[model samples]
Each structure stands twice: as C-alpha cells, then as structure tokens.
Target: MSIEPAGHGIEADNALDRRFSGRNEAVPDEAHHDGRGRFYWFLIGMRGIFSLPALILMTSYLGFAAFALDVGLTRSEAVFIWALPAQMILVGTMAGGAHLAASFAAVTFSSIRMMPMVASVVPDMRNDKTPTIVLLALSHFIAITSWVFATQRLRHVPRPYRTSYFAGFAITLTSINTAIVGIGYGVVSAFPPVVAGALFMLTPVYFISSIWASARQPVVKIAFLFGIVLGPLFAVIEPQFDILYAGIGGGTVAYAIDRVRRRRHAAGGV
Candidate 1:
C-alpha cells in the first residue's frame, strides 16, 4: 500500500477505502474464482466465530434461552424466534390473548428494518456468476451480527469469494448460536433473569461499537446519531413502538440529510 498524508474523519475514511478496495493482489483473481479459493475463504469466514461480535451474540442467546423457557416455548421455538425480534412480540401478543391478525401485523411492522440490511449488503457481495437464487438463500442469514461482521471485512476479500466468505461466517455463527440456545434451554431455571439480562446487554454495546467502526458512509453516521437521540425519547413516549419509530424516523432523516449533502457537494456548493 502507498503511504500518504493522513486525513481527518470522513476524509480519512475515504483514504482507507481507496487503500483497500480491490487491493488484495497477493493472489490472482482467477485463483479466487475457483473451487479451492472459495473453500479457503469460506474457512476464513468461519473464523469469525472467535470475533467479539460473535462472542457477544452467543452470550446473548443464553438469555434468549431463559426467555423462551419463561414464555413456555420449546427449545426449537426459541431458536426459531431468536432471529426476529418481531416474532418475540408475536409470542408475547398471543400469550396476552391477542388476535392472530394483530400478532401478525406486529411481526410484519417489526420486520421492516431487515429489508435495508439485506439490500445494502447483497450488491457489494455480488459478481457476474453469482445467482439471484443464491443471494436470496443467503439473505436468511443476514442479521445484526453477520451484517456488521461481513460489511467490515468484505472490501478486503476478492469479489468471487465474498459470498462464500459470508456464508462461512454467517452459517458458523448461526449454528453455534443455535447450539447455545439448545444446550441452555432446559437449564434456564438455574440461569435466572438477572444473569440472562446482563448477558443480553452485551449485544447492543457491541452493536454500537461495530456499527461505528463500519459506518464509513455519512448516512450511516447520521442515522446512528439520530437513533441515539430518538431512541430514548420515543421509549418514554411509547415503549412498544419506540424501536420502530426510532429506526424508521432516524434512517429517514439521515437519508434526507445525506442526500442533500451529496447534492450540495456534487453542485460544488460545499
């Protein structure tokens, strides 16, 4: 890599991006396109289980095990709903004697945040031979841990191996987490809510850190800022919808601000 004078903030970030984008010339592109290369990267991706985010996620699922037990759900049910927070709401609503339609509506609304996460990561990982079906299949594994893990690492990986790399990491992470829940399922009575709650708290703490590290785009930082400001405010106003409102409202505001900034910069007015 060429050495250059350092820049500040976003300028520094762009410099880093310029430094890494397609710069992995240690192996030729053809090598990565082959079965051997894909397998190698897949194994490399599996190493993500040792990462901090993966560890945090694994720890959090222990809490989820307790939650599942408390809710009278089977071990399999806990693993099923663990990925989608909205489904947890569905369980809670149905437990409260809510109608099926109402429970389904709540799950649908809570799931809206997943759309952007899937959209943002897929294009960057795609190549000429990558099929739409494969991408769609892989989308099921795209969650907070995998998204953050993959986004921060994908730029350095070869285009052809990106999907395999993601699959390795995501599948490994998911499998281990599932195992954690399964093993902890019948043992939740000994775990206690206080212990479980403390363990679950690691997720957001790592989430904020990981998001900040990978948020090179101005919109991402803007959204993070707005989320921080709006989350608690909305929590007090309406706890149930606080997450929905804060996420949508912050992202919308951030997107608008980023769009305006880009336009101004493009027009040479900044």
Candidate 2:
C-alpha cells in the first residue's frame, strides 16, 4: 500500500530478515542472502536457452515489415500505418528527427519499469563494488519468464544462491535473444514472402500465450475477457482508442466488483 526508496547498501535489518520469510518470497535464502550452487546456476542458465524460440518469434515483425516493403509499401508508410500510433506520436514529438529517438524512449520506459526487479536482486549480491556492478548489469536480462521462474520455482533455494541462479538464467536468455535477432534478420532476408508472413504470427501467439499464462488476478482475468470482447467494438468506432477504452472500462468494472466483494466479505465477518 505504501512505497519506500530502495536502499543503496545491504544493511543488517529486521525488514530484510522478514523479506526472506514471506510466503510469496522470491528468493530461498531470504535470511542468509548467499547465492546458489554452480550446478543449479547451470540449470537456470538453461532457461536462457529457451529465449531463442521467443526471440525468433519476435523477429517475425521485421520479416512482416520486409514483406510489406516488398509488396510496394514504403518503410515509413508501412510503419506509420501498421505500427502503434503512440510510436508515431513519439517520433513526431522528437522535433522532426529520426524515429529511432522514439524507439530509444520506449526502451527507456521499459528500463524504468525494470528497475524494481533489479532492486529486488541487489540485496543478495556480494557486498563489494565489482560484484554489485556485475550483478546490476546482468539484471538487465531478467524478464517476465526469469522473474516468474525465480519467484515461483527458485524460492526454496538458499538466499545466497537465488541471485546467482537468476543471474545465470538472465545471462543465458540474453545470449539467446542476441543470437536469435541475428539469425532471424538473416533468415527473413533469405526466406520467401509467404514464409516470412507466417513467421509474423509468432509475435501474436507468444503474446497471447504469455497473457493467458500470466493472468493470475481475478481483475486481470476479467479485464482480459472484456478486452477481447470490447476491443473490436471500440476499434470500429475509433481504432487507435480501442485499447485505452477497453483497459479503462474493464478495469473500472473489475475494480467495482472487487470493491463490492470486499464489502460483502467484511459484512459477513468471514
């Protein structure tokens, strides 16, 4: 319910002790803060390898764009129409410079959201400048998959090992992404238009799967359901505003339901 500034140095505190004990605690050694074993780290690293398929799927976008280009669409023309308008708006806001500025802004936003995960791992690092920097740098690789695995699967490991295991997982996944991007770029260039078009489905499939897998809360579930139904309806009226309408509308409905449920439960004294 409240937010606090993330600490700079690891300190001996009761709060830190409690952080390792909660039921939903992400790390195993919440108390000791020691990292996991090398073998365990290796297994975690395997998760990184799984990133290849996901990254390959992502690269399908580039392929689809190329296909669009080959079919007589200009690069800017295709991007302006097919890509999210927010992207175009961002570029337009950049004072008539290259659209890469908008791309950088989007990345910066993602990085800002990523800071909390990095903060969660910071306490477990070895209390030295070099190790801290190394861990922080490696933390960039921590994505939803690694975070979910770390929080759900690795919580039983000792605290000392959790950070190391996560680091291994992150490092491997990063390598997988790097490799897939390079491969996908080359593959899309060499493949036929139909094949490239087929590959573009990978992005939507990946996103659908991820959303289905990660929709844990009742609010999220309801919002997703409503979004699916209402999205197209709103798109018919105003395409660019569909997501905003569905998200805000569904979220409002979900919040009201949750509020009423809480009130009823309180009245029932359950």
What are the clash counts of all predictions, listed in order?
0, 10
CA deviation > 4 Å runs, candidate 1: 1-27, 79-84, 192-194, 236-244, 262-270
Which 10 residues in a row give candidate 2 its minimum summed lDDT? 1-10
**What are the RMSD figures for all models against the true structure?**
4.8, 10.6
- Structural similarity to truth (TM-score) of each candidate: 0.82, 0.50
Across 1-270, the per-residue lDDT of candidate 2 in tens digits comes to 111111212322333454456435544434444333555665755654455343543464456444444454445454443222233344444434547766677545434434554564455443332355667666655554444444333433444555566667665655554444444442356767677666766655554444544443456556557767787888898775565676667667877887787789899996
Candidate 1 residue pairs in backbone clash: none
Pairs in clash, predicted candidate 2:
20-30, 29-158, 29-159, 33-160, 34-160, 34-161, 35-160, 35-161, 36-161, 48-173
Model 1 clash tally?
A: 0
TM-score computed on alpha carbons, candidate 2:
0.50
Q: Identify the leading candidate in terms of TM-score.
A: 1
Per-model lDDT: 0.79, 0.51
